[model samples]
Target: MNTPCDIPALQLSERSFGLLRSLFEKETGIHLRGEKRHLVIGRLQRRLEQRGLHDFESYCALLQQPHETQERQHLIDALTTHETYFFREPAHFQHLREQALPNLETRPLRIWSAASSSGEEAYSLAMTLADTLGPDGWEVFASDVSACSVWQAIQGLYPQQRLDNMPKGYLKRFCRRGQGVYTGQMLIHADLRARVNFFRHNLLADDNKLGEFAVVFLRNALIYFDATRRGQIIGKVVRHLRPGGYLYLGQSESFSEPLTSLEYLGGSIYRRPSCPAIARST
Candidate 1:
Protein backbone atom coordinates (compact mmCIF):
# COMPACT_ATOMS: atom_id res chain seq x y z
CA MET A 1 0.00 0.00 0.00
CA ASN A 2 1.31 3.45 -0.90
CA THR A 3 1.04 6.18 1.69
CA PRO A 4 -0.31 9.62 0.69
CA CYS A 5 3.12 11.26 0.88
CA ASP A 6 4.80 8.37 -0.95
CA ILE A 7 3.17 9.35 -4.23
CA PRO A 8 4.45 12.68 -5.50
CA ALA A 9 1.84 15.29 -6.39
CA LEU A 10 0.77 14.55 -9.96
CA GLN A 11 -1.65 16.58 -12.10
CA LEU A 12 -3.91 15.14 -14.74
CA SER A 13 -3.23 16.67 -18.16
CA GLU A 14 -6.20 18.30 -19.92
CA ARG A 15 -6.42 15.56 -22.56
CA SER A 16 -6.12 12.78 -20.00
CA PHE A 17 -8.69 14.38 -17.70
CA GLY A 18 -11.14 14.79 -20.60
CA LEU A 19 -10.63 11.16 -21.59
CA LEU A 20 -11.29 9.89 -18.10
CA ARG A 21 -14.23 12.24 -17.61
CA SER A 22 -15.89 11.16 -20.85
CA LEU A 23 -15.32 7.50 -20.00
CA PHE A 24 -16.84 8.00 -16.56
CA GLU A 25 -19.92 9.71 -17.98
CA LYS A 26 -20.34 7.08 -20.70
CA GLU A 27 -20.18 4.25 -18.18
CA THR A 28 -22.00 5.80 -15.18
CA GLY A 29 -23.89 8.94 -16.37
CA ILE A 30 -21.87 11.04 -13.93
CA HIS A 31 -20.64 14.21 -15.62
CA LEU A 32 -17.33 15.43 -14.34
CA ARG A 33 -17.12 19.04 -15.42
CA GLY A 34 -13.89 20.96 -16.01
CA GLU A 35 -14.04 22.30 -12.47
CA LYS A 36 -13.81 18.75 -11.07
CA ARG A 37 -10.36 18.17 -12.57
CA HIS A 38 -8.60 18.33 -9.24
CA LEU A 39 -11.24 16.13 -7.59
CA VAL A 40 -10.82 13.48 -10.27
CA ILE A 41 -7.05 13.60 -9.86
CA GLY A 42 -7.26 13.34 -6.09
CA ARG A 43 -9.62 10.36 -6.21
CA LEU A 44 -7.84 8.34 -8.91
CA GLN A 45 -4.18 9.05 -8.07
CA ARG A 46 -4.03 6.27 -5.51
CA ARG A 47 -5.59 3.83 -7.94
CA LEU A 48 -2.89 4.59 -10.48
CA GLU A 49 -0.15 4.20 -7.88
CA GLN A 50 -1.63 0.94 -6.61
CA ARG A 51 -1.67 -0.44 -10.12
CA GLY A 52 1.98 0.60 -10.51
CA LEU A 53 1.13 3.02 -13.28
CA HIS A 54 2.95 6.33 -13.69
CA ASP A 55 0.23 8.67 -14.91
CA PHE A 56 -3.43 9.11 -15.84
CA GLU A 57 -2.62 8.35 -19.49
CA SER A 58 -1.48 4.84 -18.66
CA TYR A 59 -4.55 4.33 -16.44
CA CYS A 60 -6.84 5.38 -19.31
CA ALA A 61 -4.97 3.07 -21.68
CA LEU A 62 -5.42 0.10 -19.36
CA LEU A 63 -9.15 0.81 -19.13
CA GLN A 64 -9.51 0.71 -22.92
CA GLN A 65 -8.33 -2.91 -23.18
CA PRO A 66 -10.85 -5.75 -23.57
CA HIS A 67 -11.99 -7.73 -20.46
CA GLU A 68 -11.23 -4.80 -18.16
CA THR A 69 -14.77 -4.71 -16.91
CA GLN A 70 -13.79 -5.10 -13.26
CA GLU A 71 -11.11 -2.43 -13.64
CA ARG A 72 -13.67 -0.03 -15.10
CA GLN A 73 -16.01 -0.74 -12.21
CA HIS A 74 -13.22 -0.09 -9.74
CA LEU A 75 -12.63 3.25 -11.43
CA ILE A 76 -16.31 4.17 -11.13
CA ASP A 77 -16.34 3.15 -7.48
CA ALA A 78 -13.26 5.25 -6.79
CA LEU A 79 -14.80 8.35 -8.36
CA THR A 80 -18.22 8.01 -6.73
CA THR A 81 -19.01 10.52 -3.99
CA HIS A 82 -20.49 8.54 -1.10
CA GLU A 83 -21.16 11.56 1.15
CA THR A 84 -24.32 10.78 3.16
CA TYR A 85 -25.59 10.57 6.74
CA PHE A 86 -28.58 9.21 8.62
CA PHE A 87 -31.49 11.60 8.13
CA ARG A 88 -29.16 14.24 6.70
CA GLU A 89 -32.07 16.14 5.19
CA PRO A 90 -34.44 16.19 8.17
CA ALA A 91 -37.42 17.78 6.40
CA HIS A 92 -37.75 14.95 3.88
CA PHE A 93 -37.98 12.32 6.59
CA GLN A 94 -40.42 14.49 8.54
CA HIS A 95 -42.64 14.78 5.47
CA LEU A 96 -42.49 11.05 4.85
CA ARG A 97 -43.51 10.40 8.44
CA GLU A 98 -46.20 13.08 8.59
CA GLN A 99 -47.61 12.95 5.07
CA ALA A 100 -46.54 10.17 2.70
CA LEU A 101 -46.66 7.17 5.00
CA PRO A 102 -50.19 7.95 6.16
CA ASN A 103 -51.52 8.31 2.62
CA LEU A 104 -50.01 5.16 1.13
CA GLU A 105 -52.73 2.58 0.42
CA THR A 106 -50.58 -0.36 -0.51
CA ARG A 107 -50.46 -3.36 1.85
CA PRO A 108 -46.70 -3.83 1.70
CA LEU A 109 -45.63 -0.20 1.33
CA ARG A 110 -42.42 -0.12 -0.73
CA ILE A 111 -39.86 2.71 -0.67
CA TRP A 112 -36.76 2.94 -2.83
CA SER A 113 -33.62 4.73 -1.71
CA ALA A 114 -32.56 5.15 -5.32
CA ALA A 115 -29.02 6.36 -4.62
CA SER A 116 -28.39 4.90 -1.20
CA SER A 117 -24.76 5.50 -0.27
CA SER A 118 -23.34 3.21 2.37
CA GLY A 119 -26.88 2.57 3.70
CA GLU A 120 -27.60 5.71 5.72
CA GLU A 121 -30.64 6.90 3.76
CA ALA A 122 -32.06 3.39 3.31
CA TYR A 123 -31.72 2.58 7.02
CA SER A 124 -33.27 5.93 7.86
CA LEU A 125 -36.22 5.05 5.61
CA ALA A 126 -36.51 1.68 7.36
CA MET A 127 -36.62 3.30 10.79
CA THR A 128 -39.32 5.75 9.77
CA LEU A 129 -41.41 3.10 8.01
CA ALA A 130 -40.95 0.62 10.84
CA ASP A 131 -42.09 3.24 13.32
CA THR A 132 -45.01 4.53 11.30
CA LEU A 133 -46.13 1.38 9.47
CA GLY A 134 -44.88 -1.28 11.92
CA PRO A 135 -42.31 -4.02 11.35
CA ASP A 136 -44.09 -6.10 8.72
CA GLY A 137 -45.82 -3.24 6.92
CA TRP A 138 -43.02 -1.92 4.72
CA GLU A 139 -39.98 -2.73 2.58
CA VAL A 140 -37.01 -0.54 1.54
CA PHE A 141 -35.06 -1.27 -1.60
CA ALA A 142 -31.66 0.42 -1.94
CA SER A 143 -29.53 0.63 -5.04
CA ASP A 144 -26.23 2.29 -6.01
CA VAL A 145 -23.89 2.25 -8.98
CA SER A 146 -20.99 1.51 -6.66
CA ALA A 147 -20.66 -2.16 -5.76
CA CYS A 148 -18.58 -1.28 -2.68
CA SER A 149 -21.34 1.01 -1.46
CA VAL A 150 -23.98 -1.68 -2.04
CA TRP A 151 -21.85 -4.14 -0.04
CA GLN A 152 -21.61 -1.70 2.86
CA ALA A 153 -25.37 -1.15 2.72
CA ILE A 154 -25.85 -4.88 3.18
CA GLN A 155 -23.46 -4.92 6.19
CA GLY A 156 -25.45 -2.13 7.93
CA LEU A 157 -22.62 -1.37 10.36
CA TYR A 158 -21.77 2.28 10.89
CA PRO A 159 -19.69 4.49 13.13
CA GLN A 160 -21.53 5.99 16.11
CA GLN A 161 -21.04 9.53 14.82
CA ARG A 162 -23.22 8.74 11.84
CA LEU A 163 -26.15 8.29 14.21
CA ASP A 164 -25.89 11.71 15.87
CA ASN A 165 -28.56 13.26 13.64
CA MET A 166 -30.91 10.26 14.01
CA PRO A 167 -33.75 10.53 16.51
CA LYS A 168 -32.89 9.13 19.94
CA GLY A 169 -35.88 6.81 19.96
CA TYR A 170 -34.95 5.41 16.58
CA LEU A 171 -31.32 4.97 17.65
CA LYS A 172 -32.41 2.95 20.64
CA ARG A 173 -35.19 1.04 18.92
CA PHE A 174 -33.55 0.09 15.62
CA CYS A 175 -29.83 -0.19 16.34
CA ARG A 176 -27.45 -1.64 18.93
CA ARG A 177 -24.44 0.20 20.36
CA GLY A 178 -21.15 -1.67 20.20
CA GLN A 179 -19.26 -2.61 23.36
CA GLY A 180 -15.62 -3.30 24.25
CA VAL A 181 -13.96 -4.88 21.20
CA TYR A 182 -16.46 -3.25 18.90
CA THR A 183 -16.48 0.18 20.51
CA GLY A 184 -17.44 3.37 18.66
CA GLN A 185 -19.60 1.47 16.19
CA MET A 186 -23.32 0.79 15.84
CA LEU A 187 -25.11 -2.00 14.05
CA ILE A 188 -28.66 -1.55 12.78
CA HIS A 189 -30.96 -4.09 14.46
CA ALA A 190 -31.11 -7.31 12.47
CA ASP A 191 -34.86 -7.08 12.02
CA LEU A 192 -34.64 -3.53 10.66
CA ARG A 193 -31.64 -4.48 8.55
CA ALA A 194 -33.57 -7.41 7.16
CA ARG A 195 -36.32 -5.05 6.04
CA VAL A 196 -33.97 -3.30 3.60
CA ASN A 197 -32.64 -5.04 0.46
CA PHE A 198 -29.51 -3.67 -1.24
CA PHE A 199 -28.56 -4.15 -4.86
CA ARG A 200 -26.17 -2.75 -7.48
CA HIS A 201 -28.03 -0.69 -10.07
CA ASN A 202 -26.87 1.71 -12.74
CA LEU A 203 -29.52 4.37 -13.23
CA LEU A 204 -28.22 4.97 -16.77
CA ALA A 205 -28.90 1.35 -17.76
CA ASP A 206 -32.18 -0.25 -18.84
CA ASP A 207 -32.48 -2.86 -16.11
CA ASN A 208 -35.51 -1.61 -14.12
CA LYS A 209 -36.32 -5.01 -12.59
CA LEU A 210 -36.52 -3.52 -9.06
CA GLY A 211 -40.29 -2.98 -9.56
CA GLU A 212 -42.57 -0.05 -8.80
CA PHE A 213 -42.33 1.84 -5.54
CA ALA A 214 -44.85 3.85 -3.56
CA VAL A 215 -42.16 6.43 -2.77
CA VAL A 216 -38.79 6.85 -4.49
CA PHE A 217 -35.98 8.81 -2.87
CA LEU A 218 -33.56 9.71 -5.65
CA ARG A 219 -31.87 12.42 -3.63
CA ASN A 220 -28.56 14.17 -4.14
CA ALA A 221 -27.47 11.88 -7.00
CA LEU A 222 -28.90 13.95 -9.84
CA ILE A 223 -26.57 16.92 -9.42
CA TYR A 224 -23.77 14.96 -11.09
CA PHE A 225 -25.55 14.45 -14.37
CA ASP A 226 -25.99 17.01 -17.16
CA ALA A 227 -29.46 18.24 -18.10
CA THR A 228 -30.22 15.68 -20.83
CA ARG A 229 -28.99 12.74 -18.79
CA ARG A 230 -30.73 14.03 -15.69
CA GLY A 231 -34.05 14.20 -17.52
CA GLN A 232 -33.49 10.74 -18.97
CA ILE A 233 -32.76 9.29 -15.54
CA ILE A 234 -35.84 10.92 -14.00
CA GLY A 235 -37.97 9.52 -16.84
CA LYS A 236 -36.66 6.02 -16.10
CA VAL A 237 -37.18 6.38 -12.35
CA VAL A 238 -40.69 7.75 -12.86
CA ARG A 239 -41.56 4.64 -14.88
CA HIS A 240 -40.96 2.58 -11.74
CA LEU A 241 -42.90 5.03 -9.59
CA ARG A 242 -46.50 3.96 -9.09
CA PRO A 243 -49.30 6.38 -9.88
CA GLY A 244 -49.81 8.86 -7.02
CA GLY A 245 -46.39 7.82 -5.69
CA TYR A 246 -44.04 10.43 -4.27
CA LEU A 247 -40.61 11.21 -5.70
CA TYR A 248 -38.04 13.06 -3.60
CA LEU A 249 -34.99 14.86 -4.91
CA GLY A 250 -32.22 16.58 -3.04
CA GLN A 251 -33.13 20.10 -1.97
CA SER A 252 -30.53 21.46 -4.39
CA GLU A 253 -31.49 19.35 -7.40
CA SER A 254 -34.21 20.10 -9.98
CA PHE A 255 -35.50 18.87 -13.33
CA SER A 256 -35.07 21.18 -16.32
CA GLU A 257 -38.00 19.70 -18.22
CA PRO A 258 -41.59 19.57 -17.04
CA LEU A 259 -42.90 16.01 -16.43
CA THR A 260 -46.50 15.72 -17.53
CA SER A 261 -47.15 12.74 -15.26
CA LEU A 262 -45.83 14.43 -12.09
CA GLU A 263 -46.84 17.54 -10.21
CA TYR A 264 -44.50 19.50 -7.94
CA LEU A 265 -45.51 19.03 -4.32
CA GLY A 266 -43.02 21.42 -2.62
CA GLY A 267 -39.72 20.99 -0.73
CA SER A 268 -38.16 19.05 -3.60
CA ILE A 269 -41.05 16.59 -3.69
CA TYR A 270 -43.21 15.58 -6.68
CA ARG A 271 -46.23 13.32 -7.07
CA ARG A 272 -47.23 11.17 -9.99
CA PRO A 273 -50.85 11.85 -11.02
CA SER A 274 -52.94 8.87 -10.01
CA CYS A 275 -54.55 6.85 -12.76
CA PRO A 276 -58.31 7.29 -12.97
CA ALA A 277 -60.42 4.49 -11.52
CA ILE A 278 -62.65 2.42 -13.83
CA ALA A 279 -66.35 2.10 -13.18
CA ARG A 280 -67.98 -1.35 -13.14
CA SER A 281 -70.72 -2.10 -15.74
CA THR A 282 -73.89 -3.17 -13.94
Candidate 2:
Protein backbone atom coordinates (compact mmCIF):
# COMPACT_ATOMS: atom_id res chain seq x y z
CA MET A 1 0.00 0.00 0.00
CA ASN A 2 2.96 2.33 0.51
CA THR A 3 4.19 4.40 -2.44
CA PRO A 4 7.93 4.41 -3.25
CA CYS A 5 8.35 8.05 -2.23
CA ASP A 6 6.49 7.48 1.00
CA ILE A 7 9.25 5.25 2.42
CA PRO A 8 11.85 7.13 4.43
CA ALA A 9 15.55 6.91 3.68
CA LEU A 10 17.43 4.19 5.61
CA GLN A 11 19.09 5.66 8.65
CA LEU A 12 22.68 4.60 9.41
CA SER A 13 23.50 5.54 12.99
CA GLU A 14 27.00 6.28 14.22
CA ARG A 15 27.20 2.88 15.92
CA SER A 16 26.03 1.05 12.80
CA PHE A 17 28.47 2.92 10.59
CA GLY A 18 31.36 2.24 12.93
CA LEU A 19 30.55 -1.45 13.10
CA LEU A 20 30.21 -1.70 9.32
CA ARG A 21 33.41 0.21 8.74
CA SER A 22 35.34 -2.01 11.10
CA LEU A 23 34.00 -5.15 9.45
CA PHE A 24 34.82 -3.81 6.00
CA GLU A 25 38.36 -2.96 7.02
CA LYS A 26 38.86 -6.34 8.63
CA GLU A 27 37.68 -8.16 5.51
CA THR A 28 38.82 -5.96 2.61
CA GLY A 29 41.76 -3.91 4.01
CA ILE A 30 39.98 -0.79 2.76
CA HIS A 31 39.61 1.86 5.44
CA LEU A 32 36.38 3.82 5.35
CA ARG A 33 36.61 7.04 7.27
CA GLY A 34 34.01 9.27 8.89
CA GLU A 35 34.04 11.38 5.76
CA LYS A 36 32.85 8.48 3.61
CA ARG A 37 29.62 8.03 5.62
CA HIS A 38 27.43 9.35 2.84
CA LEU A 39 29.31 7.43 0.18
CA VAL A 40 28.82 4.20 2.13
CA ILE A 41 25.11 4.87 2.60
CA GLY A 42 24.63 5.72 -1.07
CA ARG A 43 26.31 2.54 -2.26
CA LEU A 44 24.49 0.21 0.14
CA GLN A 45 20.93 1.56 -0.24
CA ARG A 46 20.22 -0.76 -3.16
CA ARG A 47 21.17 -3.78 -1.03
CA LEU A 48 18.66 -2.69 1.55
CA GLU A 49 15.95 -2.37 -1.07
CA GLN A 50 16.85 -5.67 -2.65
CA ARG A 51 16.62 -7.51 0.68
CA GLY A 52 13.54 -5.50 1.74
CA LEU A 53 15.30 -4.30 4.83
CA HIS A 54 13.84 -1.23 6.52
CA ASP A 55 16.84 0.36 8.19
CA PHE A 56 20.62 0.26 8.41
CA GLU A 57 20.39 -1.47 11.81
CA SER A 58 18.53 -4.41 10.32
CA TYR A 59 21.06 -4.68 7.48
CA CYS A 60 23.87 -4.60 10.02
CA ALA A 61 22.11 -7.28 12.00
CA LEU A 62 21.76 -9.41 8.90
CA LEU A 63 25.43 -9.09 8.23
CA GLN A 64 26.26 -10.23 11.74
CA GLN A 65 24.33 -13.47 11.52
CA PRO A 66 26.18 -16.76 10.91
CA HIS A 67 26.55 -18.27 7.42
CA GLU A 68 26.01 -14.91 5.71
CA THR A 69 29.19 -15.20 3.72
CA GLN A 70 27.41 -14.55 0.44
CA GLU A 71 25.60 -11.59 1.97
CA ARG A 72 28.89 -10.24 3.27
CA GLN A 73 30.38 -10.59 -0.17
CA HIS A 74 27.39 -8.75 -1.58
CA LEU A 75 28.00 -5.95 0.89
CA ILE A 76 31.63 -5.81 -0.22
CA ASP A 77 30.62 -5.77 -3.88
CA ALA A 78 28.26 -2.94 -3.21
CA LEU A 79 30.72 -0.86 -1.22
CA THR A 80 33.89 -1.31 -3.26
CA THR A 81 34.53 1.21 -6.00
CA HIS A 82 35.46 0.02 -9.54
CA GLU A 83 35.93 3.20 -11.56
CA THR A 84 38.45 2.50 -14.34
CA TYR A 85 38.98 3.19 -18.04
CA PHE A 86 41.19 2.07 -20.88
CA PHE A 87 44.82 3.24 -20.78
CA ARG A 88 44.42 5.14 -17.56
CA GLU A 89 47.65 7.03 -16.75
CA PRO A 90 49.08 6.69 -20.24
CA ALA A 91 52.60 7.34 -19.03
CA HIS A 92 52.74 3.96 -17.27
CA PHE A 93 51.94 2.12 -20.50
CA GLN A 94 54.43 4.26 -22.40
CA HIS A 95 57.14 3.37 -19.91
CA LEU A 96 56.21 -0.28 -20.13
CA ARG A 97 56.46 -0.23 -23.92
CA GLU A 98 59.66 1.77 -24.26
CA GLN A 99 61.56 0.79 -21.12
CA ALA A 100 60.39 -2.34 -19.32
CA LEU A 101 59.50 -4.60 -22.25
CA PRO A 102 62.85 -4.33 -23.98
CA ASN A 103 65.02 -4.90 -20.89
CA LEU A 104 63.57 -8.24 -19.83
CA GLU A 105 65.50 -11.37 -20.92
CA THR A 106 62.60 -13.68 -20.24
CA ARG A 107 61.21 -14.92 -23.56
CA PRO A 108 57.59 -15.19 -22.45
CA LEU A 109 57.32 -12.07 -20.32
CA ARG A 110 54.79 -12.36 -17.52
CA ILE A 111 52.77 -9.39 -16.26
CA TRP A 112 50.18 -9.00 -13.52
CA SER A 113 47.49 -6.34 -13.46
CA ALA A 114 47.16 -6.66 -9.72
CA ALA A 115 43.86 -4.82 -9.45
CA SER A 116 42.57 -5.04 -12.97
CA SER A 117 39.02 -3.78 -12.58
CA SER A 118 36.70 -4.38 -15.52
CA GLY A 119 39.65 -5.52 -17.74
CA GLU A 120 40.78 -2.17 -19.13
CA GLU A 121 44.22 -2.19 -17.57
CA ALA A 122 44.61 -5.91 -18.22
CA TYR A 123 43.51 -5.55 -21.86
CA SER A 124 45.82 -2.61 -22.30
CA LEU A 125 48.70 -4.73 -21.03
CA ALA A 126 47.68 -7.51 -23.42
CA MET A 127 47.66 -5.13 -26.37
CA THR A 128 51.08 -3.73 -25.57
CA LEU A 129 52.56 -7.15 -24.86
CA ALA A 130 50.98 -8.67 -27.93
CA ASP A 131 52.38 -5.93 -30.11
CA THR A 132 55.81 -5.90 -28.51
CA LEU A 133 56.44 -9.56 -27.68
CA GLY A 134 54.06 -11.26 -30.12
CA PRO A 135 51.15 -13.50 -29.10
CA ASP A 136 53.07 -16.49 -27.73
CA GLY A 137 55.82 -14.43 -26.10
CA TRP A 138 53.74 -12.86 -23.33
CA GLU A 139 50.95 -13.61 -20.88
CA VAL A 140 48.83 -11.46 -18.53
CA PHE A 141 47.21 -12.33 -15.22
CA ALA A 142 44.51 -9.93 -14.03
CA SER A 143 42.79 -10.12 -10.66
CA ASP A 144 40.48 -8.08 -8.43
CA VAL A 145 38.83 -8.34 -5.00
CA SER A 146 35.34 -8.10 -6.45
CA ALA A 147 33.96 -11.25 -8.05
CA CYS A 148 31.52 -9.11 -10.02
CA SER A 149 34.45 -7.18 -11.41
CA VAL A 150 36.39 -10.39 -12.18
CA TRP A 151 33.41 -11.64 -14.19
CA GLN A 152 33.21 -8.32 -16.02
CA ALA A 153 36.90 -8.52 -16.83
CA ILE A 154 36.42 -12.03 -18.20
CA GLN A 155 33.62 -10.82 -20.47
CA GLY A 156 35.92 -8.18 -22.01
CA LEU A 157 32.99 -5.90 -22.87
CA TYR A 158 32.67 -2.20 -22.21
CA PRO A 159 30.64 0.86 -23.09
CA GLN A 160 31.94 3.00 -25.95
CA GLN A 161 32.71 5.86 -23.61
CA ARG A 162 35.21 3.74 -21.67
CA LEU A 163 37.47 3.56 -24.72
CA ASP A 164 37.88 7.31 -25.16
CA ASN A 165 41.38 7.29 -23.72
CA MET A 166 42.49 4.03 -25.39
CA PRO A 167 45.52 4.34 -27.63
CA LYS A 168 44.83 5.16 -31.26
CA GLY A 169 45.36 1.92 -33.18
CA TYR A 170 44.31 -0.42 -30.41
CA LEU A 171 40.60 -0.08 -31.01
CA LYS A 172 40.92 -1.13 -34.62
CA ARG A 173 43.32 -4.00 -33.92
CA PHE A 174 42.25 -5.41 -30.56
CA CYS A 175 38.53 -4.67 -30.30
CA ARG A 176 35.29 -5.25 -32.14
CA ARG A 177 32.65 -2.55 -32.28
CA GLY A 178 29.25 -3.87 -31.32
CA GLN A 179 26.39 -3.37 -33.76
CA GLY A 180 22.63 -3.89 -33.88
CA VAL A 181 21.28 -4.65 -30.39
CA TYR A 182 24.75 -4.23 -28.85
CA THR A 183 25.59 -0.83 -30.24
CA GLY A 184 27.40 1.55 -27.90
CA GLN A 185 29.51 -1.32 -26.57
CA MET A 186 32.86 -2.74 -27.52
CA LEU A 187 34.34 -6.18 -26.95
CA ILE A 188 38.05 -6.90 -26.67
CA HIS A 189 39.10 -9.07 -29.62
CA ALA A 190 38.78 -12.74 -28.76
CA ASP A 191 42.48 -13.42 -29.20
CA LEU A 192 43.47 -10.63 -26.87
CA ARG A 193 40.84 -11.73 -24.35
CA ALA A 194 42.25 -15.24 -24.38
CA ARG A 195 45.72 -13.90 -23.64
CA VAL A 196 44.68 -12.27 -20.36
CA ASN A 197 43.32 -14.56 -17.64
CA PHE A 198 40.95 -13.11 -15.03
CA PHE A 199 40.53 -14.26 -11.44
CA ARG A 200 39.09 -13.24 -8.08
CA HIS A 201 41.88 -12.43 -5.66
CA ASN A 202 42.06 -10.67 -2.33
CA LEU A 203 45.22 -8.66 -1.90
CA LEU A 204 44.86 -8.93 1.84
CA ALA A 205 45.08 -12.71 1.73
CA ASP A 206 48.41 -14.52 1.93
CA ASP A 207 47.66 -17.17 -0.68
CA ASN A 208 49.88 -16.40 -3.67
CA LYS A 209 48.78 -19.01 -6.17
CA LEU A 210 49.35 -16.74 -9.21
CA GLY A 211 53.15 -17.05 -9.08
CA GLU A 212 55.74 -14.42 -10.08
CA PHE A 213 55.70 -11.64 -12.67
CA ALA A 214 58.23 -9.45 -14.49
CA VAL A 215 55.91 -6.45 -14.29
CA VAL A 216 53.11 -5.89 -11.79
CA PHE A 217 50.55 -3.11 -12.27
CA LEU A 218 49.11 -2.15 -8.88
CA ARG A 219 47.85 1.23 -9.98
CA ASN A 220 45.23 3.63 -8.64
CA ALA A 221 44.05 1.19 -5.95
CA LEU A 222 46.15 2.12 -2.93
CA ILE A 223 44.44 5.47 -2.41
CA TYR A 224 41.66 3.76 -0.46
CA PHE A 225 43.88 2.46 2.34
CA ASP A 226 45.67 4.16 5.23
CA ALA A 227 49.42 4.28 5.61
CA THR A 228 49.77 1.04 7.57
CA ARG A 229 47.33 -0.88 5.39
CA ARG A 230 49.09 0.46 2.32
CA GLY A 231 52.42 -0.83 3.56
CA GLN A 232 50.90 -4.20 4.43
CA ILE A 233 49.40 -4.60 0.97
CA ILE A 234 52.51 -3.36 -0.82
CA GLY A 235 54.72 -5.71 1.15
CA LYS A 236 52.47 -8.68 0.47
CA VAL A 237 52.10 -7.98 -3.26
CA VAL A 238 55.80 -7.27 -3.75
CA ARG A 239 56.59 -10.88 -2.82
CA HIS A 240 55.15 -12.06 -6.14
CA LEU A 241 57.45 -9.80 -8.16
CA ARG A 242 60.41 -11.62 -9.63
CA PRO A 243 63.89 -10.41 -8.87
CA GLY A 244 64.64 -7.28 -10.91
CA GLY A 245 60.97 -6.96 -11.77
CA TYR A 246 59.05 -3.66 -11.91
CA LEU A 247 56.06 -2.55 -9.85
CA TYR A 248 53.90 0.37 -10.98
CA LEU A 249 51.67 2.40 -8.70
CA GLY A 250 49.29 5.24 -9.46
CA GLN A 251 50.90 8.60 -10.15
CA SER A 252 49.24 9.96 -7.01
CA GLU A 253 50.50 7.29 -4.56
CA SER A 254 53.93 6.96 -2.99
CA PHE A 255 55.44 4.58 -0.45
CA SER A 256 55.35 5.79 3.11
CA GLU A 257 57.92 3.28 4.24
CA PRO A 258 61.39 2.63 2.89
CA LEU A 259 61.59 -0.82 1.30
CA THR A 260 65.33 -1.50 1.24
CA SER A 261 64.91 -4.35 -1.27
CA LEU A 262 63.22 -2.07 -3.82
CA GLU A 263 65.08 0.69 -5.57
CA TYR A 264 63.15 3.81 -6.46
CA LEU A 265 62.95 4.00 -10.25
CA GLY A 266 60.98 7.25 -10.40
CA GLY A 267 57.71 7.94 -12.27
CA SER A 268 55.81 6.10 -9.56
CA ILE A 269 57.74 2.93 -10.34
CA TYR A 270 59.96 0.72 -8.18
CA ARG A 271 62.25 -2.11 -9.13
CA ARG A 272 63.26 -5.09 -7.02
CA PRO A 273 67.05 -5.30 -6.98
CA SER A 274 68.25 -7.61 -9.72
CA CYS A 275 70.41 -9.56 -7.26
CA PRO A 276 68.66 -12.82 -6.42
CA ALA A 277 70.22 -12.61 -2.97
CA ILE A 278 68.25 -9.46 -2.21
CA ALA A 279 64.95 -11.12 -3.05
CA ARG A 280 65.92 -14.40 -1.41
CA SER A 281 67.18 -12.70 1.73
CA THR A 282 64.09 -10.54 2.05
Candidate 1 per-residue lDDT, tens place, 1-282, comes to: 333676565767898888888888888988787888877877888788889998888998999888888888888898889999999789999999998877888878889999998999999999988888777868899999998899988998899987899999999999998889869999999998888999999997877567889999999999888889888888899889998799999998756667656777789888877862521111
Query: Each model's TM-score, in the order given?
Result: 0.92, 0.92
Total clashes in model 2, counting residue pairs 3 or more apart in sequence or in different chains: 0
lDDT to native, each model:
0.87, 0.85
* Predicted structure with the largest lDDT when compared to the true one: 1
Model 1 C-alpha RMSD vs. true structure (Å) is: 4.3
Candidate 2: residue pairs that collide: none
lDDT of 2: 0.85
Q: Please, what are the lDDT tens digits per residue for candidate 2 over residues 1-282?
A: 222555555678999999899888877899888988878877788788999988899989999998998888887777888988888899999999998887888857889998887889999999988887777878899999888899989999899988999877989999999999879999999888998999888887886577889999999888888888788888888899988799999998865666657877788888888885654221
